[model samples]
Target: MASQEKIKLVLLACGSFNPITNMHLRMFELARDHLEDTGRYKVVKGIISPVGDGYKKKGLVEACHRLEMARLATESSEWITVDDWESQQPEWVETAKVVRHHHAEVLSSENNSNGDDVDTGKYRKRRKMEKKSPSCMNPKADRPHLNLLCGADVLESFGVPNLWKPEDIEEIVGRYGVTCITRCGSDAEKFINQSDVLYKHRKNISVVREWVTNEISATHVRRALRRGQSVRYLLPDSVVRYIQDHSLYSAESEQKNAGVILAPLQRYSKTE
Candidate 1:
């Protein structure tokens, strides 16, 4: 009798990660723990893909900065890696496409390892087989299963009107699946029950309830920085230093004209 092959799992976390916080990193651990608790998957890699500048959200900062911050944040973690592919894109690419692109890259690399070109149609068929199989079993056992890791806030937003396309939602949930870490007051079950699409694909969504919640957000961090308050424990020390050194999120950052006004003062002032 042959032994069962262990299934490989990789998590892709897509977000702004303007200044990657401890909570952002925690989501990966929470999801990995939840999935490993099932005794069905062995999580190999965790990828943090920051959103492109094309998102155009206020206070988003630049993609280069965000990517560097993410890299710095996760440098100590062996399992986690930062992928700049999405950030390097010329324009904003949808989340679904990002997932597909990562999956394709993984598949292409795996195929190259075997010295063969990947066939898109055949890969899709293989994915379908893998998805249908039991947790501990896979027909094509070698391929790694890529899942989207996010917070419950992101999960709830999926149901928001005009936020995401119907097809993209279907592809994300139906194909890659999601592992959402529950935030305080965000009912993952209730959100699923309320939405027909979510309810239908509930099997693919794993809701990991967090007992002790960390309410630290980038917005809050930025606000604290702008007010000249201590964000010491909110962000990593290295990131904190980076922000201070770069003068990011400060009141001066918001005031474009401040440089001109302060140029003369800076020349005369000892604190300059």
Candidate 2:
């Protein structure tokens, strides 16, 4: 499905990058290596959908700020590309449409089109733009063999993608692939069971097991930030500093447990 214009792949990560952390980068790093080891080699495909902006998830600054930071955080990595599509989508659609978009492109080739009506010169430029533009060029799948990345909690919430429905998620995952960096034991099972329904794409649902990031959590980093302690070992240093720079969960809150602070806010601040 590739043309002389561009070589594309999707490396997806979904989460409340509430302010992305180092663990997030580490996860990506591991993801690339894991894919290479398996011979897929295009490990650094690109992030399809990422989580950001919510009430209880109360992003410290805002989505735009978070997106800028993410751009800065992964600016240096060739393998990383941000799909701000999810954050920008008003009602985030199922990841399947995005996956289907990729697949459609793959299923169809650029030059494969019938050349009867179109001018050759304009067509060449349009094909060029398709490679560089982040937006889907064709109405079909660009890279149908999509793989989504997420943590244990997000993986556990796989069934709940219904929250975004009438957009079906399981069907979407069935179309592409589900690559998870697992934490919870239950989600590991859920990912497997869900694959059964997707018998067609079962091989695509792969797990990038993590013994390294097992204990990493955004809530934990937020707690450390509030205590004015070093969260150096937790999230990415860039992320820690970004949180501090923005005064997110800083010592001013005097709240030791981030969960308590975020939870009571839901009960106390109904307008949120």
Candidate 3:
């Protein structure tokens, strides 16, 4: 059996890994490297959410297709995974439940070690971490750990009142700590001000502003591909291949002829 992945700290870098690119890798690297350097987390992994059955985008393809693409891109990286719980959910009502599930999975794995076959290298790294950092033990216990991932654009109204109740949103963020990544324009402060219930109750919001790297988003990648331009380097090669193979992100007009454009998924998660 595949040695169950060591689950330590859960850094939910949730996003619509539409095609899964190298930039995603960079982001994963950034999170892992940061956590490793500062001893902030144990196992920080990225969760890709491709909209499942419940939703639909004008030109978007099927949920399974997107999910497959994400999986394909992340095949090599043990730190990243394509989580379908949210994607496959019939509605957003199950968001909090899923968050708790992820948390339980992490904690349970740490407590229940299955066998004696341990990677000596991983063992050494764990030993070094334990020896050097007092904060490493029960890593989740004392530290202000929510989900640590960064985001650039955050809109308060993105939460459609009809679609999601405030309590629902609150439960997800509250249940699992959210370490927000802020880039300037995200109306973040407004969200905090408006979200008095979640924000005020928590000890302190965990947010960080690392350098805002390339602003080129998934949209840009699609546009470039549709125009027969190069989106290379901006996004990882895997994403490019998947998009090409699946023919995602064609021009708005081409979408009609091509059948599906791909999910218009602005999948808003706790962190992205």
Candidate 4:
């Protein structure tokens, strides 16, 4: 009997990450655990890549700020790391390009003898062709398998017009694979089946249903902050402190009122 070869799996989570939340980090862990349980993959790394300012999403903070906040959120986690490549891009590169770049980086670092880097050139050529040919089923074994990680909400939006190109969807779901963490009331299978391309490559899509929901979203957190409410446990302590020190999200008047409210509590606590 021969021992099965260990498959190195890396996850690239690209998004606004305007302010990294617990839910964002949780998806990585959920995906890693689910993949590892299959006994076919060894999850090595998870990279959180914030979208560049080129995305122009409303309420999106500066790329530098988002990058630092992500760093702070994941600094203590050993396997999870933050990548600024996407954040630093002068123009908004498509998600497929971001995934490919990271995959290339992984292959280059491994120094695999099987010409993993050469395959990237082939990928570029494939992108240029018009015909919808299925990508290579068997990629270089030595190269780590890189996949995109996102919430089910994102998965459902793939079919929306003007959001994702057909070629990009094929490449992302077909070539790179995706792990979608299911949100409450989201039917990933239904959405996948609705799209001809997504359905064809549905095998590459892994949907992990989350039973215990943590409905913590960046929007909700921002709203709470704006309303001068406590968001202590919703995010990591370091992230919370960063938000406080940097005065992010909260309106100027709200922050001033919050300070006034906290001063008395601070003084009373100090006396005790």
Q: What Cα-based lDDT does every candidate model obtain?
A: 0.79, 0.55, 0.54, 0.79
Write model 3 residue lDDT over 1-272, tens digit each, in one string.
11132224566655555545665556666655655554444554566555554444344555676787778777887878877777777643234455555654554444345542344666456545633542223433432233635453532433543434466556555445555555556756567667676456343334544575645566566667778998878765776676778667666633542443222233433323
Model 1 is weakest, by summed lDDT over 10 consecutive residues, at 259-268
lDDT of 1 at 133: 59
Query: RMSD of each candidate?
Result: 9.7, 8.0, 9.2, 11.3
Q: What TM-score does each of the candidates earn?
A: 0.84, 0.64, 0.67, 0.82
List residue ranges in candidate 1 displaced over 4 A. 1-4, 114-140, 252-272
Model 2, 1-33: lDDT tens per residue? Answer: 224223234566765565577677777777666
User: What stretches of model 2 exceed 4 Å from their correct place?
Assistant: 1-8, 48-61, 90-144, 160-167, 184-187, 194-201, 250-272
Residue 229's lDDT within candidate 2 is: 81
Please estimate how well model 3 matches the true structure, expressed as its whole-model Cα lDDT: 0.54
Candidate 4 residues 7-77, lDDT tens each? Answer: 78899999988689988999999999898887767889999999987765656677888888899999889
- Candidate 4: count the clashes: 0
TM-score head-to-head 3 vs 4, winner: 4
Error of 2 at 78 (Å): 2.2
TM-score of 1: 0.84
Which residue pairs in candidate 3 collide?
Answer: 9-43, 22-236, 59-261, 59-262, 60-262, 60-263, 61-262, 146-177, 147-177, 150-181
Q: State which candidate has the highest TM-score.
A: 1
